[model samples]
Target: MILLLLILTLLSLSRGRPNSSIVNHSTQLLRRLGVKRVPFQFDPYKEGLYYTNLDQNLRQVILNARNWTQISTLSNIDFIRAHNVELGRMQQTIPASSRFPCNLSQTRSPDVASHISRLRPGDIDIVAAFGDSTIAGTGIMALGFWDLMVEYRGFAYTGDGIESWRTVLTLPNILKLYNPNLYGYAVAHSLSADVKRSRLNVAEPMLYLLDLPFQVHVLIDRLHKDPKVNIHVGPNDICSELCYWHDLEAFLRLEERQLYASFRLLRDNVPRLLINFIIQPDIDDVMNVFSEMPDDCTTKASFFCNCHGKYKQEKYYNVAKRFFDMQKSIASLPELQRDDFAIVTHEIFKNVSNLWSRNGALDKRFMANDCIHYSQLAHAVLAKLLWNNMLNQTDFTLSEARRRPFEYFLCPNADRQFLRTTGDRF
Candidate 1:
């Protein structure tokens, strides 16, 4: 009887269809070990289709493909929904937003669930967001907002997550990916060391600078044509002390002029462009937190403690605040205000910092070992905040929102996720 059972198990493995009872036990073991793998790989560019791999005995697909076009043609893609099994469709799937206990989850009504189920492919919004580390979703050991959105099947364009990307670099890249025709005409240049100057030199190199007129024209035209697509530009223009209010103001002025030109070209092509900014924790508060630490708690002991050698602390703080204030002023500009163009400022981190401060020092609960970056909890909060913001926008209709609320967001809890171990790396 034991020999017969062993033979049956071997047959099951060879057939690629393990008994449901056996799969359940394996899944439980994987869940306890805190790791799970999706059953199949999906190609996002090709409308999230799945491909099948035949056993060694069968003739393999695309065995002799010489190039990408040929490989694409030969791919044995399984388009039938019944054959393309989704792991998330299982009954015991984990919640998408359950990475941390602090992360909030929404409960939708039955009506909402019905609408979500009825949502078809291409109904989801696709956003091309541009920014530095913050917009890229840099955290100690957490999923970036872009990652979360991608995992949930709400299409968000991604680039080098660690690159020191600026507006000039991002805008052209966005065009290149979205409008290849326009991108063909856009000039290509290496990023300059001086972050303040544009490589194109048509205007001040900042978020507001619209040097590539043709690219912007194509971008707006595409946005008008595709209502499901949106644009998000969050520029962290001021990184060092060299950038100031005048530079940011000048940059915004250039951006406004270009935007106006685009609007004039296509009267109804106004995009729901979100010019969003995040207000950081107060420099004064951060400095006070450092001061309260023991003498032994130097930069070596704690990355955030006594950083800048106490002498340069105030200077860094002052420079940061200068840019922060400038961003607020730009957001308030009457000329920049319009139905299609919206300026969003997030101060939740600042507010939380105040609450977390005790004895003139911030607790490390929501902060990372380095005082500047956020902790896992903070990353979860930021993900939800950004997700909610996306939902509130016109790009996310009610039907779309209903579908994405419960979708699995991959990499919710990744340990040791950051690269380069150093205080100044950030």
Candidate 2:
């Protein structure tokens, strides 16, 4: 019987058919392995589409299109919207509920010492930061902007943090040396990017730098305790900038399901977590609405994805609201924020925008050509956020701030340099 089943499964699989034999084999594999599903098939729903089939649209939209209407109303065959945004009432500012993050800062203060101190001295620690490219550190560029990299907390958003392929990214993640003033080694960090991007800058390397510190903390903690624990995940989640193109309903259902599942998995396993949710931080994100949507799409509020990416990103931010709610649900016990949890997000992006605005920063190492990601300033922002968190928890005192590792710099003067009309020469 098993032999017959195996033969039939091979026959079906070979024919590229979704027949009973193939389904049964996959089903059997799932059952035998005691797993609900496997993601080997890009579209787990067997929807007959995959990422390999979804690349061209990105270029057409980013490189060719002149406006939002051209990009949003795609023609011809279908492609999935990787994200969804609701085109609701356009306000001048983001709703207050959507602006400030939950009062985690207030609630967790009392329990920090108690919870952090209770953890086993040497138990490994893990911190995970997930989201789009801002999470990936694709900041400032050398060809156009230099000092621009000093925005997204510095290097925290650029490379994949892996030491492998060097793709000469838009935001070149090179070390700016003070001793030599410019003699740092060419860091052979990994993660290659293709030049075919709409521009020279590779897309944001999300899920990379954001996960490192916590992972390192966990690794070091385990080195002193146990040598076999890993921490933090990368920016490989199925997030994208063009998700606004999908039919709002379908886009949202898929997004909610995926996010819900992702959060649920973390909730189930890791009680102590740090998250850096990266939705666009623009004044426009709050004020814009796209009423020119399809007639049947009556749920304008639910599918808020319109392309006012700058100064307005309402469609982009609504997603953040949901992520936080999910956190509140999972950490319902109330004490998780003290020792085992935290979240860092892009607040006041407009403030950081001009700092590295056009990506032609004075700091050549900043801004990836992709108009996102980071160099140094980006890393600085991340470190600052975490550093401030530790401060809030009293994990480290003011005097000990020097011992805490993270490079922070807010360049108010970089505006002139970033917007320099002069030729590019960092």
lDDT of 2 by residue, 1-426 (tens): 000000000001111122344224333433442334323535423321122223322323332222232223323102211111111101122333542211212221223233332321112122222233343233322122332222221233322221111212111122111011211111221111111111111223333222222222222222233222222222121122223334434543443444434434443444444333332333232232122222332232122222333213555456534533433343233432334443333232323333332332222223233323344333433343332332232222232232212323112122211111112121
Q: List the residue pairs that clash in candidate 1.
A: 208-255
lDDT of 1 by residue, 46-75 (tens): 211122232121211221211122223224
Q: How close is every model to the real structure, measured as TM-score?
A: 0.35, 0.37
Off by over 4 Å in 2: 1-154, 157-188, 192-227, 230-246, 271-306, 309-351, 354-366, 393-426
Worst 10 residues of 1 by lDDT: 1-10
**lDDT per model vs. reference:** 0.29, 0.27
How much is 222 displaced in model 2, in angstroms?
14
Say which candidate scores most in lDDT. Answer: 1
Clash tally, candidates in order: 1, 70
How many backbone clashes are present in model 2?
A: 70
The global Cα lDDT (0 to 1) of model 2 is 0.27
Give model 2 RMSD, 1 decimal: 18.6
